[model samples]
Target: MSDQQENKVVISLDDLLAQAQLLKKQIDDLSAARAELLDSVASIEAAKASIQELKTQQEMLVSSDKKGYLMFKINNQPPQKVLVYLGLSYYVEVDMDTALKILDERENELKEASTGLDKKLAESKAAYDQIVDILNQIQAQAQQKGE
Candidate 1:
C-alpha cells in the first residue's frame, strides 16, 4: 500500500511539472504581448506630438528612408486632414482634431490591454510558484524517506 501511494505521488508530481512548463510559456507570451502593447502606445503618443508640432511649425526635416542617411523637409501646411492607421493595414482619413481624438482612444485601449496582461501574468506567476513549492516539499520528503 505504501509503494502504491508513492507511485501515485510521483505521477502527480510529473503532472505538476508539465503544468509548470505550460504556465511558464503562458507567462512569457503574456509578457511579450504587454510589451508590444506598450510599444504601440508609445508610437501613438509620438504621432500625436508630431501632429501638434506640425500645427505650429511651417516645415520639419524628415528622413525618406529607415536609416535617415538622406533627409528632406515635410513642409507642413497645417494639414486640415491626416491619415490614421486603424490596424491590419487599414487607414482612415480624418481632420486634425478627429485624428488626435482617435489616437487618444487607441492609446487608451492599448494601455488597458497591457493592464489586463499584467494581471494575467501575476496570476500565472503565483500559480507557477505554488507548483514549485509543492515540488520542493515533495522532494524534501523523498530525501528524508531515503535517509
Candidate 2:
C-alpha cells in the first residue's frame, strides 16, 4: 500500500502516445494562442505608454500656448502668431485623445483573448485527465487478471 502511494501511477508508452496525441495537439494550439495573447498585452501596454507621453506633450503645448497668450498681451505680438500656436496645441490634444482611445480598445481585446485561451487550456487539461483515468483503469484490470 505504501509503495503504491509513494510511487506515482504511470501509463505504458503505447497507450500514452495514442491518447496524448489529441491532447498534445490541443495543448500546442492553446500555447500558441497564449503567446499571441501575451504579445497583444505587450502591444497594448506599449500603446498606453505612448499615449501617456503624448498626453504629457499635449499638456506642455497647452501651457506654452497660455504663456504665448500672456506675452501677446504684454509684448504686443502679432495676433496671427498666437492664433497659429493655439491651433497647434488644439491639434496635439485631439491627436493624444484619439491615441488614448485606441490604447483602451487594444487593452480590452487582449483581455478577451486571454480569457479565451484560459478556457481552451482548461478543456485540454480535462481531456488529458480523462485519458489518464482510462489508462489507469486498463492497467488495474490487467493486474487483476494476472492475479
Candidate 3:
C-alpha cells in the first residue's frame, strides 16, 4: 500500500475537545453510579452486621430462661420489634424458628445482590477511567498541533 493510504487521518482539536467532554461526562456518570453502589454496599454491610448481632443476641436468649426480642429501626422513625423465642426448651417454639429462618433467607439474598452490584460498579468505574486516559491523550496531541 502507498504511504499516504497506509497512514490514518488525524483528528482535529475541536473534535478532540468535544470527545473529551463526552468522555468526561461518562466518567462522571460512572463515578456517580459507583458512589451509589458504595452506599448500597455500606447498607448491606450494616445489615449483615446487624443480622450477626441479632443472632448473637438470640443465642444469648437461648442460654437464658427469659425470651429475647429484636428491635428494628427504619427511616429514622419509631422502632419495631418481634419476639425471638420463648422461655424454657427453646426448640418448643415453632414461631421463633420460622422468624429466624426468614431472617436468614433475607440476609443471604441481600448479600448476593450487593456482591453482584459491586462487581458491575467496579467494572464500570474501570471503563470510565480508561476513557478518561484516552481523552487526555487525544487532547494532548491536539494541543501539540498548534505549536
Candidate 4:
C-alpha cells in the first residue's frame, strides 16, 4: 500500500482502540452502579420481610392477650407504638395496620426500581460485549496485516 494509505489505516485502528477503551470504562461504571442498586434492592426486600414478621407478631399478641397487654420491649422499655421509617432519617409513630400498609407500598416501589435497574444492567452488558467483539476483530485484522 502507498505510504499515505498505510498511515490512514494505522490512524483508523488507533481511533477504534481509543473508542473501545472509552466504552469499556463506561460499561465498568454502569456495572458498578448496577451492583450498588442490587444491594439496595436486597436491603429493601429484607426490610419488607422484617415488617411483615412484626405485623404477624403483633396480630398474635393481640389475639392471645386477655389483660390488654402484649409482651414486647423497645429501648429496654415496653413498646408504645410502631415506628415506621419515612426515609431521610425520618420516622412516624403508627399503629400496626398503618405500618403494614406503608411497608407494602414501599415494597412495591422497591420492586419496580429493581426491575428498572436490572434492565439497564442488561443493556450495558450487551453493549460491553459488542465492543469487546469489535475489538477482537480489529486485533485479528492487525495480526493478519503483520503476517
Q: For each candidate, give its TM-score against the true structure.
A: 0.83, 0.56, 0.44, 0.62
lDDT of 1 by residue, 61-147 (tens): 767775789998787587789899998999999988899999999999999888899999999999999999988999999999999
The per-prediction tally of clashing pairs is 0, 0, 0, 0
In candidate 4, what are the lDDT values of residues 1-147, reduced to their tens digit? 598776763436667667767767776776677677667667556655655666445432232253556653323333346788889999999876677688778767766776776777677678667767877988899999999
Report the Cα lDDT for residue 90, model 1.
98
* RMSD to truth, every model: 4.5, 13.9, 11.1, 9.0
Q: List the residue pairs that clash in candidate 3.
A: none
Q: Sort by lDDT, best first: what order?
A: 1, 4, 2, 3
In order, candidate lDDTs are 0.89, 0.65, 0.55, 0.67
Better of 2 and 3 by lDDT: 2
Predicted structure with the largest TM-score when compared to the true one? 1
Question: Model 4, residue 131: what's the lDDT?
Answer: 66
Candidate 2, residue 135: Cα displacement in angstroms equals: 0.8
- Kindly give the stretch of ten consecutive residues in candidate 4 with the minimal lDDT sum: 71-80
Q: Model 2 off-target regions past 4 Å?
A: 1-19, 57-94
